[model samples]
Target: MANHKSAIKKIRSDERKRLRNRYQHKTARTHIKKLLTTKDKEEAQLLLKVVHGMIDKLTKKNIIHKNNAARKKSRLAKYVNKLVATA
Candidate 1:
């Protein structure tokens, strides 16, 4: 539907970016779920670090809101701490 060549190129580029963002978001969510289900304190701690990095990257890329990232990281940290406390 785009009549101009530039508009067509923009649409193509936007599609690619959208796919990339979707993939990253899905991957992050998968990791978060894995972390949430982990019973081992050591493993959970490792996953917490990795998940935090992924969340920070998403925030920096503007794929997710900063507050959303912060909330995720906070909850994850609390969960990991609770695991440690129990152990």
Candidate 2:
């Protein structure tokens, strides 16, 4: 219950941003999981490209930590490479 009009508007904007960020983060996680589960190297590689881009963007926006982004990318890359090598 914001008493001031500006304060109310700020709260509304914050809520909107929060929801948008949450959506993006969730999407990123879902895509990462999908990539991990994918057995097809080609498809998974494509998905990894997109996922990596999403992670980089999130890192740039400070939605996730830089180290977190790096770690995720590293692990995913390793998994994807293993799939590629085995295929």
Candidate 3:
């Protein structure tokens, strides 16, 4: 339990931030999933671009590490490229 008033306020702020981050993360995951599930290369590429922007925003906001974001983008891009090649 937070004994001090400041600590209590901090706890409240933390909770709010946690919820915000979770929402953003879940949204990002859903976008990525949609991109992966897309069969059309052009559509996938368009979704990938949006996902890339979302990842970058997450990284900038410190919701996820920059390297982690980069890795995800790289893998997603690779997958999109392979699909394009196959189609």
lDDT of each: 0.95, 0.93, 0.93
lDDT tens digits by residue: candidate 1, 1-87: 999999999999999999999999999999999999998899999999999999999999999999999999999999998885335
Model 2 whole-model lDDT (C-alpha atoms): 0.93
Cα lDDT for residue 16, model 3?
98
| TM match of model 2 to true structure | 0.91
lDDT tens digits, residue span 4-80, model 3: 99999999999999999999999999999999898888888889999999999899999999999999999999999
- Backbone collision tally, model 3: 0
Instruction: Pick the winner on TM-score between candidates 1 and 2.
Output: 1
Question: Residue 28 of model 3: what lDDT?
Answer: 99
Mark the regions of model 1 whose C-alpha exceeds 4 Å error after superposition.
Answer: 85-87
User: Which lDDT tens digits does candidate 2 get at residues 1-87?
Assistant: 889999999999999999999999999999999998999888888999999999999999899999999999999999998885334
Model 3, global lDDT: 0.93
Give the C-alpha miss distance for residue 79 in model 2, angstroms. Answer: 0.4
As a whole number from 0 to 100, the lDDT of residue 28 in candidate 1 is 99
